[model samples]
Target chain A: MNELPMSHHKHNDPLPETVLRVKALESLLVEKGLVDPAALDALIDTYETKVGPRNGARVVARAWADPAYRERLLSDASAAIAELGFSGRQGEDMVVLENTPQVHNMVVCTLCSCYPWPVLGLPPVWYKSAPYRARAVAEPRAVLEEFGCSLPEDVEVRVWDSTAEVRYLVLPMRPRGTDALNQAQLAELVTRDSMIGTALPRSP
Target chain B: MNGAHDLGGMHGFGAISPEPDEPVFHADWERRAFAITLAMGAYGRWNLDMSRYARERMEPAEYLRTSYYEHWIHGLQLLLIEQGLLSAAEIEARMQRIAAETDAGAES
Candidate 1:
């Protein structure tokens, strides 16, 4: 077996070493006719633009505007999300938990960084970090506080530990003073961290 | 077996420092690493679960020491070699050639 490329670099500079290794691998793969650079670009485009938190934001906005949709979203999140055309790997099994006036929901994958990629795109570094992963479930209140999201003492907090079989999306409660905002406008308030249950939607 | 990659609920890693206005790719190389990994993954030879397992299967020390994308490229290399797509000798030779070229460029 080949040794990991990480060991080859001794200097503190990691970015250039990683870049060089990736380039070497890419060139070899292309020369072998196993992969095309165009395919790489397409994959990047799909994640960066076509699929992302914006897709989840649209779903959240629609849910906030339509009580019926919200009901469906809560009842069967996977199907409800699919209704908006977001489904596939890493999202095969999804459960949408809602945050209400009385309770808040947070998500963490204790085993691996299994996330709903179709909606959230790539998981953030913090989301995959050891600090967040280990602490998110242990002290969720403190974690949220660190993210500048403080909750009422009366409200309850629930943490969901994601597994290989199921991933989760947190439907944060719509902020007040936004009843007049349309779905499109509401989407603007739905930040990625809010959907991840780390923070709340921005007030209008 | 549980590995370092399964870091949820553990401790001592450090504070969760959030970078304000962080870019999608911190460095140009990260973009290349991300894109190349995805491109190679498109072959459909291995599934996402397998990829995750590859990263998780590393030694605890190495896994904890390596960066995220480093883990990714490590797993990619391991998978490609295992799948008969590339050989260890070929990879070593390529790295040596790259090192030599870089040294030559620096000296000139």
Candidate 2:
């Protein structure tokens, strides 16, 4: 494996290129004055702001509020998440991996970028990088440590290699000092890094 | 199972044919894809519903066949084209025009 120049994880699929060509076509239209750039701009803008991390945060909050819901989220994440009105999309076979002192779970799409979109939203850049993917599985502790997270020696690290059938989301142990917080306040703690088990949720 | 980006057993238990020299990504494309969609989302222009839609609705093979950035690029184009920001013919014409302009510029 070390002898090979390219890591297998590189996105070698032809479809994304096809997708780009279509965009090229669209941009070509923009240059021709046939399409409206403002509308195009607006649509892209909406995804960046309205679509990230919030859905996952909501699920985390709900899990904290209701035990039964949390149970369902653990057992049948797809159905449970849909209850909060955040299901479907790319990762439908979503699995919520709860983090505890006894065990910790991290996710990587070694082939490309597999993420629990139905919950965690899109993965962060660092999550999909070559260094993170290659290292997370081989030396999970070191990787977590780099992200400023340290687990007791007793806890076992279980890195989830995302497959086509099942997707994963880390249900991080809710950060302390948040017991008195409301839904909105709790949601703020669910950063993309924490959800992947790399960083702990920050109270601030 | 397989998706757009599956590289056989390249990642694991089995061995597969190797790729020719290592692939290096162009940073600007990732930045543009992330920045533009995010800027648009932040501005309240559109939601990432399309990525979700594609992730769920599109056939798994198509999903696997696309790169991470390619998926966004596809989603972005669909969002733009669907919204009528550009017509099919206009884009085709523009590609030709850009090619011509580039060719002419090269001559000078």
Candidate 3:
């Protein structure tokens, strides 16, 4: 899903202090020959387009369409995800949790920004914000509600605290009346927030 | 060092305002910062753990004051200088030049 334009700042304004610091560092790094500009561009390109939520969406869609795949995903998420060639740093040990009628799952890394980078690309600014890190664990239900996800009283909410040793991904339930849809179409309904357990997959 | 960056379950930081259509980077320099950090990391001179530690090791006030990518550039600068890739003097001089350029732009 394309991100809606963030209204945090006025476009075409002067860059922030952090931006200047970053620019200085990049210039220094290149001037010193510590980093190759071309290599940097290639790396940026990979995360910007080639990898990200789309990769994770495909995995979720595949699991939703195939029961065997769902079983494998739950039993050994790392291997199952690697099946789709989405395995690398921060994702070396991933555990996929299935959302069900009785169970809801959410993921948060309390310590720093330990995330499944290969599958999720870089984490969003909100995900890295001080407010999110502090509130996600203390008041997970309220946090979910803020994200527009309200669970029934009968459903149990499980918040997975991600660590450097292991990262977690939430496999959102397939929407109703999607039985007719193929895996590719199912992926179209799967947004990044769904896998993060902040929001549910779009209804068809 | 369990610093401000380890912000899980703490309070008073306020609500997360997600920009409706936030680009991956807010500024051109932010994109470059992301790329440079990744590029330096790719060289294998230091592990991700070290970078995290470096950022956490930053002064609490400074760490809290700086932006997310700012922590990255700070840590990257420290690591590169420590590894002898660049001298501290060179970084400081370049920063001074940048400040001067900004001042000149303001005057013009």
Candidate 4:
């Protein structure tokens, strides 16, 4: 369907130059039959609605709830995550970092915004910014502090720079008093930033 | 490539600001840019890494100054031209035409 109508730009204020340029590109591509508008809409809807951190959260929750799944996730993350149907582009290779009492793990793409799109959907704006790409690997402790997540002195911070095809996902430690919560309920506590290692899961 | 995009360990970009409840696409144009890039990519003209390299090949100053989707659009434009799918002049002429139409609508 033609959900995106050009008439939306009929406002009093003019659209930005980049906006018009993208519009022009899309129109030209459609006219040439190089791209389908419906396919474009489908792609947009898939990321905007279908795939996201919720998928990652469910994976983490399963890892926390079932010891067998946890072991599987720890050993072969790509296969285990694919078991839950989260595998595609940007997720062909995955490494899951488990946060324990002694070690804290975080992920960053120092070269580019190469995130696990299948699990986390498109990366957040902050994750793609120059500061995050520059500082996440260098001063992870200071970066964590800015995120309001200050770990204890005893815990070692490990920063995983996603330079190659391997995408890292942080499996945050389970919070206390969540023993009675079901896997779905446990998934509710996992935040996107927690999976990215910038924050911790919400306490039960 | 050691382009402006390779920002690891570099300094002076300032603090990371996380927006609360950030929407998937900041604006309508952003959604279009993201989708168009993905759709054109399905044509098998170029792979993902090639597109990334194209974005990184952008002039350093402009690369750093632009927003995320701006980088994407720039990269898409580069790929379109490189693959001979669309010429630069065609894009520019279409942009000018759209701009003129907007101006005319505003005056009416």
Q: Best candidate per DockQ, number?
A: 3
Q: Given the true complex, what DockQ would model 4 score?
A: 0.47
Local error of candidate 2 at A90, Å? 1.0
Candidate 1 clashing pairs?
A134-B9
User: In model 4 chain A, which range of ten residues has the least summed lDDT?
Assistant: A5-14
lDDT of 2 at B54: 45
For A96-116, candidate 2 gives per-residue lDDT tens digits of: 899887888877767556777
lDDT per residue as tens, model 4, A1-204: 132322121121223588899999998999999999999999999999999999999999999999999999999999999999999978999999999999999999987788998999999888888778888988899999989999999999999888548999999999999999999999999999999999999998
Listed in order, the DockQ scores are: 0.44, 0.14, 0.48, 0.47
Q: List pairs with backbone clashes in candidate 4.
A: none
Which residue runs of candidate 3 sit more than 4 Å off their true CA positions?
Answer: A1-17, B99-108
TM-score: model 1 vs. ground truth: 0.89
For model 4, the docking class works out as acceptable
Candidate 1: residue A47 lDDT (0-100): 75
The model with the greatest TM-score is 4
Which residues of candidate 1, in runs, are more than 4 Å off? A1-17, B105-108
Error of 4 at A13 (Å): 15
